[model samples]
Target: MADRPEVEISYDLERIDFERTSELIRASYWGEKRTDAINRRAFDHSACAAAFIDGQQVGFARAMTDYACFAYLCDVIVWPDKRGAGIGKKLVQAMLDHPDLAGIPAFSLRTSDAHSFYEAFGFEVSRDGMYMRFVR
Candidate 1:
């Protein structure tokens, strides 16, 4: 692991800028080209964390949680230029440490490429049968 930069992790919705977050997401293959309204609604329903350097938003992660039993982390992203700078890890730690998710029995997320990253935080691939259906 590399030394983390002096980045501030914020859970404040006011500190989240939709355009900036969407830009970071849009750059990734797992991200959809979503409109601001759509993104705003998603954030509205989720617990979100963002990383900033000199007050500039550089990374973000969010989770939809009942704050009791389940949390599904989604849309985790770090700006392309800032990848590998430890911002993503810190952003995730902030989300998991959020008061809303404390004592939750289950937390899960989907990732195609960052398995090891999440594993470092104690996430594991499910061994039991799991299922999903997309309403397309």
Candidate 2:
């Protein structure tokens, strides 16, 4: 795949096109349908990475991190048409490499599917029954 064209992954939130990103997430199965105000606020507080091909946004992944030891990766999505092109993998890599997140001891995400995709990056399922949670 050396000859495959390059896709630019960027961490500049100001360069992110919010409308496109919102639409991308809203269309996903595990997506949040948030208002523009809420979405903007989330973007403002999170370390966001987006993948662009020739200037069109095709992928996104963001992590809420303390810029120190932990990051919770969320809202990872790649446009369906672009899925097989390695954009999702590249976007996740960009998030992991973001300066605030690199070297963090722990990263966590919840996915009902795509386990193997993330496992390839060394994420392992918690040992059976090792995790407990509460939600309202």
Candidate 3:
């Protein structure tokens, strides 16, 4: 396999490719019914992270947070061709390390199939076993 290109993580909403992002999200199992308007509203309200390689977006994730108590991570997706190249990890890390989210008491996310992936980042299944959380 060829070496993966370096991934750049950015928090600037202006840098996000909304059209491509909406397409990818609408294709995802979790976001299949999501409309572009809804995505725009969500992104507008959340702290978003986008991953780029060679100036093209490869992955995206977002967090809803109050910057004091908690954060909820959502809409994590990597371009199919870019999977397994650590772009997703970088996106998640960027959200966690984002200045606004740092020191938050808890971070939570729901993933039907990516539990092991999130587990590596210290996320554990909650008592209800329906969501994963990382508590500070």
- Indicate whether candidate 1 or candidate 3 has the larger TM-score: 3
- Model 3 per-residue lDDT at 43: 96
| Shift of residue 128 alpha carbon in model 2, Å | 6.9
Q: Give per-residue CA lDDT, model 1, range 22-80, as digits (tens).
A: 76676677676677677888899899998898899998899888877788888888888
For residues 18-53, write the lDDT of model 3, one tens digit per residue. Answer: 999999999998999999999999999999999999
Itemize residue pairs with steric clashes in candidate 3. Answer: none
Candidate 2, residue 106: Cα displacement in angstroms equals: 0.8
Name the lDDT of candidate 3.
Answer: 0.93
Q: Backbone clashes per model, in order?
A: 0, 0, 0
> What does candidate 1 score in Cα RMSD to the true structure?
5.0
Which regions in candidate 1 have their CA more than 4 angstroms from the true location?
1-4, 127-136
lDDT of 2 by residue, 41-63 (tens): 88899989999999888888998
TM-score computed on alpha carbons, candidate 2: 0.86
Could you tell me which 10 consecutive residues in candidate 1 have the lowest summed lDDT?
Answer: 127-136
Evaluate residue 103 in candidate 1 and report its C-alpha lDDT on the 0 to 100 scale.
Answer: 68
Could you list the CA RMSD of all candidates, in the order they appear?
5.0, 4.6, 1.1
Q: Output the worst ten-in-a-row residue range by lDDT, candidate 2.
A: 127-136
TM-scores for all candidates: the values are 0.85, 0.86, 0.95
Top-TM-score structure, candidate number:
3
